[model samples]
Target chain A: MVEFNKISGNVWNIPKSGKMLVPATIYASERLMDTIKQDKTLEQARNVACLKGIQKSAYVMPDAHQGYGFPIGGVAAFDPDEGIISPGGVGYDINCSVRLLKTNLSVEEFMKKRHDLIEALFVNVPSGVGRGGKTRVDRNVIMEVLSKGAQWAVEEGFGRKDDYLRTEENGKMSADPHAVSDRAISRGLPQLGSLGAGNHFLEIQKIDQIYDEKIAKAFGLQDKDNVTVMIHCGSRGLGHQVASDYIKEMEDKYGFKDLPDRELINAPINSDLGQRYYRAMGAGANFAFANKQMITHWVREVFEKIYGSVEIDVVYDVCHNIAKMEKHKIDGKLKQVCVHRKGATRSFGPGREEIPDVYRSVGQPVIIPGSMGTASFVLVGTKTAEEITFGSTAHGAGRVSSRSAALQNISGEHVKNELAKKGIEIKATSWKSIAEEAPEVYKDIDEVVRVSHEVGIGNLVVRVVPLSVMKG
Target chain B: MFCYAPINYINLMPQTENMAEKYKFLQHTADAKFQAFGKTLGEAFANAALAMFAVMFDPADVKPKIEREIKTEGKDEKALLYNWLEELLYLLDTEGFLLSRVKKITIKGKVLEAVVAGDLVANGYKTHGDVKAVTYNEMDIKKEKDKVIAQVVVDI
Candidate 1:
């Protein structure tokens, strides 16, 4: 077992040993630490520290769990001139993200038609395994979506300018369609506006409490009982293909002889192969943005039809899996690094130009989606996070139970009944999917958020409890 | 001169009890993990595909209406296995093809060729979830005197 020394209240450290180039750090409460120790989370974090040019410490967030190469909710920054970029570091679903939509309707008003709204979303939003989306587009149009992202969706009249504006990087990045493969394109083409299965979902929530009134107001959550919607998904099959394609290329080129794990195979950040993968990853990220944009359009249509006239606006959109080149303080000097956050959210604090101009004074809004039939939290980024954790925090309540274990222990009917007891409605493609994503299979969201708050990486602004859910 | 067989010819071969004994699910916290056993490496790889499809839906419900030819090359056995499973996933995503069984497979050196049979995901078929991708995490292919066992973990 890997040993950890307590550094402070919510921080633990594993000093550099053997081939590690830097130390490994984990931010979690003692109770959480017990659960985290149950898996390979610490071992993966230590292996990440062994990567070339990894700066400071390889950090694991509060909701971390054992993943393939990097622990989920893992964060590490590598010097651009010296370090490397790994596809596995970014995750299979590139830019798997969460977007929050706020509505003017109150919870009371929403309650009257909760079932109707959820049913409408279920039928209108294409979901499930290997499902084609409602929007049919050819290869050329898919290329446009790859290059333009949400900008393409807005240009096609899928959403408003403000929607992309409120999104991360304006819902577009520097993407090169040439870097993306035809196979990836074919996989992504039909899945452009779909919410592919396995833990991806759409939830209708009501603001249950306000922790920081000022930040909550700035985020457009002014009062308790305000209705909101959350969309959690990613780039779908296109992104998966990109990751698979690159992993093979990187392995063939670099040959993973020095790496501790084969899945941790990487290419140098400035290398040609590395740059191409980054560009391809950006294209994949754009696909996710365009996807969410079209889904947002359908959601708006659903609301407009049900309520006649309603105001539903984008609050914020954040990527859960991605890599970005940014300047951060290292050794008291600002340096550029490639920050890889797999299953983690960027929590940029105030005064960062990367944030939207309207919210720059406050900070980026961090949306932490919970497991189905649970409470989700909206928090603001902090300077402390920027300084220590590379402006990153936990993505969600990380899974505590395996899929097969949940399949054996829980039934879909039982989960649905439990949610109904809490007055939450659910629509899903299959009962087995519901059982696999049972809330009991995950860590407590409340505890995870509390650690982030106490550690000062993210400050809780508001809490929203689900009223209805549509799972893919 | 290869002639296309009727769909009924393929459907006649239901999954054999011996084929059913080839794979078993293992416990993994975040993803689906399984082990497939066969007398030969090619048979092990074929069983791996069956194990992967079993994660998404009941393979018995699918009929072999369509046949897809898959070709891939890798540096070693591990890479070969990874590429083969990924190709199956790609077919599922692009053509909605669900693997009912591997009809034929031949592996020489690091190159592999296979013909897989399955049905398109259509009306009347129920799917549970999506397998995001195949991972090299804890991926192992072991060859013993009597049998070969391949273990794989898929991200869902």
Candidate 2:
């Protein structure tokens, strides 16, 4: 067992363990610790510490949960020269992320037309299971989307051009199609605009609570009516297929017969395994960016169809689970590293060139979505995050129990009815999923976002209560 | 005779009856749902393998004569169990083969080997459930008196 000292109320530090190149850190409240204790999240975090070229420290966010190899809310940085990139670190859902679009409509208008809006959203958005949008892409064009991300969507009239700038990596990574397998390409071709099942959602929400007035104003979320439609999804089935394909192929073919853990299977950052997986993962990420853009367009269309005139603009889109080359100050010198954020988001503070100009003063808006029937938060990045963490924060209220356990405690119908009773409308293809995502199955979002803010990892801006949701 | 679930059913696989008393086949309702039972160490592991495969397909569909071999070594009994099942999951994912039946399961200390057989079904054959990967979570193989029991929570 790795010995860890209680650094703070919610922080634990594991002194370097066996073969671990560095120490490990975990963030969680006493309540959150209960869930962490129930499983091997700490063990997994320590396992991440054992990676070859891991730099600085291996950290787990407050929402950490047990996952394949890395904990769900795990973070680690690897030396660009010596370290390797593992798919488990980034996860199968490649860039599984959250995108928030600001709207001109306010809470009052939304309240007046909530029912119509929710109904329109449910019908318009393609949701549930392998539910795909009507749009289909040919292999060549899909290869384009696989490369271009939101740009492809914009070029295809799915979204506006300005939206790209508001997105991370400008909604596209320089992806090479040849790096991906043919089967992976085939999978991406048919599922270009799709929402895969399990934890993916499209939510309609209003600014129900505001924290930092200045930051909220800067984010254009000051008033009550400022509605936001959050598209929570990622690379979809195509990404899953890609991750699965590579993990299997690398297991036998990578020439590393002795991997510590299969889920932690990886190749050096500059190696063939690393390059191929990154390219394919990037392609899937682009597909996700395009998928969300189209979904945003559909959301805009639904608002137009239902409320006649709705102004929805792209706020900011950021991915939670992804690995990207980033410049972070390490050991007093600035160097490039591959940061793997499994269930965390970038929390770049104040003046990063990557952020849109409008919110430069306040910092990037970090959208922390609450579970169904709970409250989601909007946080602003801070300079403290830059120094302590690798400018990252928690993604959401991580689950405390397994889906089966959730099902045992609550029925899907019961969960739906309960949410409905609270005046929120939820249209789901799988109520069983809703049950699995029951509010009780997760850590409190309020506490999670609060910790992120309190720890100076992220700053609070606004809290939005979901009025309606569509789940796949 | 065994009660077998259809491929086109609500959950991927339904509840099963195991010979071991210490371990029980968990329904789709437990946190670490769906495991195996036995009176000895090997029996529990063998049955756990069977239950995991049945989660993906019907045991009846698995033809036992066609053998698929697997080998694994672990630092301890629990790690061995996890590595063993993880290897099986990899085999299932890559080869398009589901090990619905485990003909034999033998363990010596922390090293073990097994033979399994099953067929792959179409994707989303059971839409109601999507188990991404198996896990070492909540794994426990204990010898309580004359019975041997082990439990694992798979990441579905």
Candidate 3:
């Protein structure tokens, strides 16, 4: 049995044992801890601690769950010269992220054209399995997208100049197109600007409460009834292909005979293959940024068509899965390390140069999306997070049950009707998806965020509930 | 019954028993996991494809209008299975190919060759979930006296 020692009210530690290089620390409340212990979450966290050059502790967020190699909300930092980089650490959807758009309209005004607006969004955004975008591009444009990210979208008249500025890494990272395979390009070519299915969604939400007026105002969420659009998606097939290719390559070069799990296969951070995978992963992240940028453009058009002239500015876009070279305090000195966050978000606190200039004083805006038809949160990063958790926090209300279990117990029609009664409309390509992603399958969002706030990783700013949802 | 010219194999077994017992989905919290059964290793791999496609859309509902030949290799049987499934996913993303059935499959050493039939997703067939990629997590292939079982878990 895995032994745990309570370090504090919200912190628990699994002491270093066996081949583990460091201890595994988990930030969760008593109630969330009970649910977390029911799975292999603690074991996975321990497995992460065994990786080479892992600094501090392998941290598991309150919303942690069982993932392939790492826990869903796992966070760890590694030394550049001695550490390893795994594709599984970054996850298959390279930069699966969330972008929040604030509109000038209020909830009362949006309710007037609710049905028309929902229908327009459903028609405009190409979603579901393997659905291509309305516009087709050649190989040249795909290359540009892999390099320039959201900048390409803005230049093509899809968005404004300041839009990319508010995104993480300015929505663009230095990427080598040559590192990406032809098959990856082919998969990403047609699917650009489309949202693929399974937990990906586009939600129309209205701010219901504000916890911190200063931070809420900083995030462009000032009023309670102000409407916002949240887009949750990722790099699509291109990212998956990059991850698969690298995992195979890594396994071939350095077999998994010594590793605890095959999915944890990796290469040294400074190795040639590691650098190539990083560049290719950056390209996939750029694809995701471009995809969300195009969708934002269409959402702007839909709003302008229905509500006349209006403003829909980007609040912030946070990457949920990524590995980045960052400077953090290690052993009482500032050092550079490669931080991998799988199913987690960077909660960089105040004065970080990576944060946008407008919110630099308050810190980065971390948007935590709840399950479907539930309350989503807007939180600000904390300095405490940087000190202990490598500036990372939970991603979402992690799943507690399987998709098959949800399918067996719930019906799509019943879920739709229940949401309808609560004034939330949902549209999807198939009923089976709705059933699989039912809210009951997820952990309590309130409890998860509460632990984040209590642990001082992410502080609550504002809360928003979905008005309508478009499932991919 | 559907027939192909390259490999003439008749489905003489009863439809209910053959179709219903080919695959069964297992429980996974955040992804799709399933177990496929067959009389031979090749049949088990083919049924694994059926289980994967079933995660997206019903294979029986997809008409076999297009045929594609797939060839892949691995250092071992586990790697071979991983490559086989990833190849199908590649076709699905690039060509919008929805699997209807596997017409023929032959495994020699660490190499696999198969001819599969399906329809383009653009041909008005409604699809639900997207299987992001295949994983080696909890993947297993077991052989018994009269049957073979191949298990897979895919990231969605």
Candidate 4:
């Protein structure tokens, strides 16, 4: 059992006890804390704090829940020179990210063609289990994708060139495809534009609320006057294979007898194997960026086919799971650190050079997607997060129930009918997925967003409600 | 739902015939978990593969139309189980096969060889979930006088 001390409003601290290098902090309210304390989230946070070169306290977001090695909302930063890189820090689906697009069409205009549009999207976006992509690339082309990311998609006419500017890292990472194994490449080649199953979706949403007028305007969001499209997917089979390959390598080279868990397998940051895994991870992340870009192209085409040519610009895209090298202040000195956000997102504040020029003064745009059939939010990063949590923020409403329990508690038909009654059109490959990912299985997203905003890690700009959802 | 009798030479041993009843699912927060049992390690390993695929779709719905041979060696029994399931997952992801049954399996030291049977999910058979990767978290393969049990948690 872990003991917590209330440090401030919406913030609690687990004291640095045992082998911890630093205390673990929990950003949650009393009500949310009850649920947070029920799981091993606190224990995982403590375990993360004990890692080598860990700086500051490990963070547990309000949406924290139990995961294999690290909690879903776990966030930690390690010194690049001395720290270790673990596959658990990045998760299996490397760069499982979200991209939000703003359209000129309003809810009233989209409602007329909602069903047809959803059907088109469901058919166009290859989804479900073991499904291949709509656009198949050869080995040579897939290598380019693994290295170039979204830039490859734009070059292939999948999306516009400017779309990369709105994406994180310009939708490109310094990926070395050669670091990836041939098996991973084989899995990725046939799945370039496909959406894998479980919590991945494509949804059409309408602006429901705008919290800050200026930020919302800068994001091109107008409450009740504009609609948007959100794509949630990842690197598909390729990323999973890369992670699996690396974990085995780490286990084979360095035994895990002393480690707390085998899943927390790692190598020194400067080691050859560590460098190789990082490059492979980058390649996997690139695949995800290109995957989302291709889907964006399909989304644009569907809109064009239904409602002529209209404005559809990308607001911003953020990765939910990744470990990237960044410069942050530690002990009053700027240090290069590898920030591992397993189920968290990078929320860089204003003045960060990585952000685009259009939003440079306002900070990076962070998209926090709620559960299926629930409200999603658009927020901006804050400097406070950089000071407290390594410029990281909560990813989403983390799951609260086991998949088995969820299936037993809710019926797919009931969830479908209930959403339909609320006027939300859902097109899914299987009703079993609907039952497994029912909104009830997730934590309260609104409250999760509230804690995030109240703590100043991420501040809200606009909220959107789903009008149609297409799931794999 | 699918059964493959051993060759006439091994018909004298009946313990492996009904060991399919040994596996059952376990509840995990975000992933799928299962525990498989057997009188011998080979049967336990076979049941573990079945439990892994059972979470993705109903094995009864899959026809044993395709047969594939899998061989992998690990440093130990635990590593062997991890590699074995990973090999099966590779077949499912790369070949689009859904596991229906295991025809035969032999565990010699750290080496595992098995003949798995299933139909192609690409043949229009439906699946309920996707098993992303098999994990070593809480993985256990234990041997006792009467039974051998293997437990695994797979990322979905």
The models' CA-based lDDT, in order, is: 0.91, 0.75, 0.91, 0.86
Model 3, span A1-472: residue lDDT tens = 5789899999999999998999999999999899899888899899999999999999999999889998799999999999999999999999999999999988899999988998999899899887888879988999999999999999999999788999999999889878999999999988999988999999999999899998999888987777999999999999999999999999999999887778999999999999999899999999999999999999999998888887999999999999999999998999999999999999999999999999999999999999998899999999999998999999999999988888889998999999999999999888888888889999999999999999999999999999999997
Off by over 4 Å in 1: B1-20
In model 4, pairs of residues that clash are none
Q: Kindly list the per-residue Cα lDDT of model 1 for residues A203-241, writing each as its tens digit.
A: 999999999999998999987767899999999999999
Model 2, range A143-198, lDDT digits (tens) per residue? 78888999999998988998888888889977876777776666556556766556
lDDT of 3 at A120: 92
Q: How far is candidate 4 from the true structure (C-alpha RMSD, Å)?
A: 2.7
In terms of TM-score, which candidate is stronger, 1 or 3?
Answer: 3
Question: Where's the lowest-lDDT run of ten residues in candidate 2 chain A?
Answer: A252-261
| Tens digits of lDDT, candidate 4, A1-472 | 8888998889999999989999999998888888888877888888888888888888988888877777889898887878889888888899999999999987888888888888888888888887879786899999999999999999999989779999999999888999998988878877889888788999999888889999888877865677899999999889989998999899989998877878888888889998999999999999999999999999999998888887899999999889999999898999899889988988889999999998989989989999999999988999998898889888998887778887778988999999999889887888888888899988998998899999999999989999999988
The estimated TM-scores of all candidates read 0.97, 0.81, 0.98, 0.96
Docking class of 4: medium
Of 2 and 4, the candidate ahead on TM-score is 4
* RMSD (Cα, Å) of model 1: 2.8
Ranking by TM-score: 3, 1, 4, 2
Largest DockQ belongs to which candidate?
Answer: 3
Query: What lDDT score goes with residue A270 in model 3?
Result: 99
What stretches of model 4 exceed 4 Å from their correct place? B1-20
